[model samples]
Target: MKAVMIREFGDPRGLAVVDLPVPVPAPGEALITTEAVGVAGADVLIRSGALAAYGFREGHIPGGEIAGTVTAVGDGVDPAWVGQRVWAFTGTGGGYAEQAVAPIGEVLSLPAGLSAVDAVTLGSSGVVAHFGLAHAHFSPGETVLVRGAAGSIGIMAVQLAISGGASAVAVTTSSTERGRRLRSLGATHVLDRSGAGGPDDPTGYDVIIDVVAGPDMPAFLDRLNPNGRLVAVGAVGGQPPADFGTRLMAAFQKSMSFATFSAATVTAAAQQAVRTEQFAAVDRGELHTVVHEVLPLEQAVVAHQKMDGGEVFGRIVLLNSPFH
Candidate 1:
């Protein structure tokens, strides 16, 4: 099998394609013949060795979400899963290959009429957005502000907020054109990435789904209304200052809250359920999957480079079959 691995870390150039023996499904796992895989911001972090403290090793295969057909199933798994088109979570790695293995519990049957590209694009990111909102205790009539709302998860958060009946869906994007694009996805207000204007200015938001947490994060705490909940789902912008907690203390009177969320923290069943629901929504035309571009599996390095360049507005998918 041909797989992309981080031959070294810190540069997109470190991602190299090499031949490897195909991985076999362990008990309760399924081996999928890859059709497509999603490249995410976390892949960039892993490639750069930023997640080493979390057990990510050098030379690791770096992909999380994949869409493919199951070719085989392990012990205790139902034979029915074999030969089914599905989307799956490959956990931290093993997805950047022609074949990948995932726990049976992590595999989801693709909704009818959903393409592999769209399946991988929305599979994991949609689950994160759904769980992030649930963590923040978002209410239907409340206002929502998706910080750095241009990535895959951020895009999903915007639409989920609207569908959940948010009185207003606000987003902080990098430019007017990107903001306009988000508006087309049902964003009611598009603010600059500076986190100003709209619900963040005077009125404040009832819930804020932030994907970018950096030095600017402390400032967004002030944008939360009383009793507001700010759930940090990703920190592509790097960590906030150690003293950032002081911001929450300063807002003590307002009872504002702040916490970080990861889909890993949620139960597998819960995550799978959300993925199923979101995929069905997409199949039904009630949700959307925004794919920035599609590249072949061999061009994994290019995909990582584009993600590092910061111009990617949505998910970038890699097809196992080369493009002619």
Candidate 2:
């Protein structure tokens, strides 16, 4: 099996393709013949060493999610899973290879019409978005905002917000073309990445799915409707400072709540259900996955470079072979 390894941190060029023995599944796990691997922002952060505090060591593989077919299952697993097409979380590492191992619980079968590429892109991101919104306590006809709205998670958040009956969906992004693309994705208003935020209307917003949090987050706090909640799901912009709460104190009167969501903590059954719902929605034409491009697995370095360049509109995935 071939995998991309990070020989060093701080540079995408440090990612190198290397060969290794294929891994066998342990108890309660399955071995997947890699078909598509998701290249995500967190994977880039892992490669850059920014997330070193997360317990991962050097020389670790960088992919987090993969979609493929089960070739074998370990003890206590159902043999029927063998030959079933599925999408899985490869835990803290191991998804960048031609073959990867995952716990059976993390693997979900793909529906008839969902291709591996679409499944990996939608399955990985959709589950995260669904979990965030589920816990954020959003309601019908309310206003919502999604930061970094042109990215994979952002796109899903926007469409899901609309479908959930939000009266309006606002987005934040740096590119004009990408903002236009986001609008087409159902964002009612698109705000510049650095701006006063969508006017201080009292209607405000009931929920916010923020993936990009930084110094300007306090501004969004004022944009939230009273009793509204802001769910911090990603820090692509940068992590909030240690005095984050002090900066946003002015919004305390609104009884606003700031919560951080990590899909890792969600139950496997819940995550699998979300993935299945998203695939079904895509099949029914009620949802869509924006794929920026499909690159070969060996081009992981180039993919990281593009992610850092900051113009990508949606998910950029890697594949081990050409498949339908």
Candidate 3:
């Protein structure tokens, strides 16, 4: 089997595709012949050594979410799963290959009418958005705001927020075209991502799902209604707000609450549920996965480069070379 491995940290240039022994499924796992895998912001961070504090090691394979066909089942697993087409999380790594292993319990069959490419595109970001919205508890007939709306997770968050029943879905994005895209996806308002154009309503927002939390924390906090919740899902912005503590103290009077969410903490089974729901939504045409591009598996380095350059919108999918 062939896999793309990080030769060293700090740049996408170090990524190399090489032949390696196929991974064997352990107990409760399934060996999958890969179809497609997601290229994500987290993958960019992993290649640059930015997530080393999270304990990422050098030489690790670079994909986490994949859509594949089960070729073999491990100990204690039902043979019925051996021939099913499934989507899964390979966990921390090992998905950027011709073959990978995923726990059988975590592997989900592709919902009818959902393609491997589409499912792979929605894989991580869609699940994160789903789990993040679960934390936001967005309700119908209420206003909701999605920060960094042009991002993969942010894009899905916008659609899910609408489907979850928010009467008005406001989003923050840097470009006019992207804003138009979000509006077409059901965003009622498109605001500049710099945290500008706020304090629009004193009643504030019923829910705020923020991914680019950092210096913009106070601004988003101000947008929340009394008892409103702000779910901080990511920090592509780098710096934490300098006055976060003081801002929190001042913002405390509104009775709003703040929580940070990482899909990393969510259980596999729980995430699988989100995956199933989102896939069904896509299949039903009630939701959409905005994929930017689909590259061949050999171009893993190019996928990482585009992500690093902030040149990608929605998600980039890598088609496993096996079928091609």
lDDT of 1 at 291: 92
Candidate 3 stretches with Cα past 4 Å from truth are: 198-203, 322-324
Can you list the residue pairs that collide in candidate 1? none
Ten contiguous residues with the weakest lDDT in model 2 = 194-203
Please give, for residues 1-324, the per-residue lDDT of candidate 2 as tens digits: 788999889889999988889999999999999999988988988998998898766789988799999999999999999999999998888999999999999999888888888987888789878888887998888888898888899999999999899888888888778878998989888778853344642347789899988777877776778888999989987887777776357766779888999997888898888788889999888899999989999999999999999888889999996321
**Model 1: how far residue 16 lies from native, Å:** 0.3
Over 4 Å off, model 2:
195-203, 322-324
Model 1 alpha-carbon drift over 4 Å, by segment? 198-202
- For candidate 3, give the lDDT of residue 26: 96
State in Å the error of residue 263, model 1.
0.9
Candidates in descending TM-score order: 1, 2, 3
The TM-score between candidate 2 and the true structure equals 0.95
Arranged by lDDT with the best first, the candidates are 1, 2, 3
lDDT of each: 0.91, 0.86, 0.83
RMSD of each: 1.6, 2.2, 2.2
